[model samples]
Target: MSDRRDVWITGIGLVSSLGEGLEAHWTALSTPAKPAVDETTYAPYVLHPLAKIDFDQQIPKRGDQRQMEPWQRIGTYAAGLALDSAGLKGNKEVLATTDMVVAAGGGERDQTVDGAILTDIEKQPNPEVFLSEQLQSNLRPTLFLAQLSNLLAGNISIVHGVTGSSRTFMGEESSGTDAVRIGWSRIAAGTSEIALVGGAYNAERRDMLLLFALKSVALHSPWAPVLADPKGVPTGSAGAFLVLESPEHAMARGAKPIAKLSGVWSERAKRGEPGAIEALVDEMIRTAKGDVSEGTAILSAACGAPEPTSAEVAAISRSGLPVRSVTDRVGHSLEAQMPVALALAALAVSKGKLFAPLEGETLEEAFEGTLTRAIVTGVGHWRGEGVALVERVD
Candidate 1:
């Protein structure tokens, strides 16, 4: 049957504002971080908790650390953990055949101008002093390479010697899910044996902070009602990835199945559409492998917005599956949310526990039904896409 080609999530690695690793991220999301104002000296934007990976331990001894942006570092760290989780450290064949895919909203856009050089060119107060300061500021002629969105995938391929297809997807907040969908399509069509698909985002730059400050999306107080306030958008970094393998390959290699990506569906939100979520969710349920009545729970990408959240609720009411808002714990991780939500679903099925929700957060009663299957929904910004994936454990 067509369902025989199962896409199993074999490993997961995550880094977020909460901390490193899956446990730390889970804890950080579960327990809110203290608030800070935007444009802090140490790092821009203090109101929302920032997810950052410690770069000190990962930098090369003699390489130019400044050349690597924070987004690159985050991607590298998370990819390493994902490979480790998948037990591919020393596997030559897997490394040779594996495909690398990066899903992100938009890559970093931080550029620093040499103050000393500009001052010297302008010939400030004291020529001798200006020249001395400029010379002291590393006057070596070095090539400057602008970081591209594809650099993350390129670097990953170079490090791992993955000569297979290397690509990236940019879908605003839905990029992570879109990347996985691409990876899954490749594996399903017998393109590659294994795929590394996830997303990484860093909001530590001045421009990103200023943008947030201008939008007023950054939560001013940790005590702010994130759910109640349509403006409570937390700014944090997250790298959520999954190592997907075909069912036949996994079973042949004696690898246990974590959870199956039974189906992935997406749709663009039309302007002025009132029931976009309902339409997309209904389509997914109608086309699901298993009956919609068997669906027990749903992991939704509500994005903490009132309209989208209400739309999700209204959709679940029609699907008749209990829905759990995963974004509540992980925040709105943009492109990284796809793999993050998938990882959470895998954990729930692998551990055989109905994952708990934060206090005072209640899903609609219709989705609260007792069943063995669940659907996870993800929605991006106003013009972004809506993605849904179905998972079941009996």
Candidate 2:
């Protein structure tokens, strides 16, 4: 049971509150990053549960780091590691052959000041200056290219000397999976040889933090026995990237592949309850090779929603795979879900281990593990954007 459209993931990179670089993040996620105590009053969202690199410790050189916004910094760092993993470095072959596609729920958050725009506006002496001034004043540099959804792609192309098609798509919650789909499409279409694809979002922003706090969507306690309160869900930022290349291309380049994207499917429900994820999950398994019932471990996209969590559990119930939730360690990263989850799943495969959620966690009862298959479920609210199913074949 093989298909010619196989997309192999030769490389992966992650920048999250859990840590930076693949190894650091891999270690942090396997361990736990739970906060010491529950302190809901002190702006509960200000910090992340765990991160191996002291962000400040990895200071960016004056100019290199200064130009990037905080959120953008996380993504750029992650992209660097991903390329490194692919053994593509800042080399000419990768630059010449790769096209890029980035996905995100929301573009970069602009923190740039208007000093430059204001100065330019002030320089105009014409009466129309005021009108143009108003428009220019609105342009802020800190957030400038750094905030653009396609900024990283543009930067990557420039840095790597890539001249292929580069673009960004907004898939709300499905951005991560969609990014992979698009990359796959391009590769299949012969539009590009290698595709750099992924998504990133900084959920720790003061506004986003406050918003989640008000929504009471985050778990007060992120570890085991997460309080039943709906408000207990925690959120964090992550940048995860995967280099998708045709099997032929990767083998030609002598790339050591981690997993092959054997199949990708997507769908949207006209109207339904939160558990609509069941159908999506079912499709991924039905199309996968071999028995979907044994030794399968599910890496769920449980963003702390009981309905969707139950929905995915029901789907996996049929396939009979052990379900594991990594969000417990990495926090809820909306756009970064696919790459991060897949990366962790790949690591688990590499190490021959299954990650257990915190004790007394609700996910323990949902999966079935025998010895033949490993299925990781990634569920999210596309909020009407749609859902995608990505199969990782070893």
lDDT of each: 0.61, 0.59
Per-residue lDDT over 1-394 for candidate 2, one digit per residue giving the tens place of the 0 to 100 score: 3334667778887777656766765565555435232235335343343244443333335465676665556666667677888888867866676877777554443323333444555667774766565557564433545566676666556544556677787665567667777787777666667988876777655545544555655455434432222234456677788888887888887987776554444455433665456776676656552554445566665566555555555775676555566666666677677667767766666555565445555545533233223454555643422223334455
Q: Estimate each model's TM-score.
A: 0.77, 0.77
Model 2: how large is the Cα RMSD against the reference?
6.7
How does model 1 score by TM-score? 0.77
Over 4 Å off in model 1, which ranges? Answer: 1-4, 23-66, 110-146, 212-229, 285-295, 364-372, 390-394
The TM-score obtained by model 2 is: 0.77
Query: What digit string (tens of lDDT, one per residue) describes model 1 on residues 8-117?
Result: 77777776655667666544444433322233542423333455446554344325345556677677667767776777655777777778788854554423434435
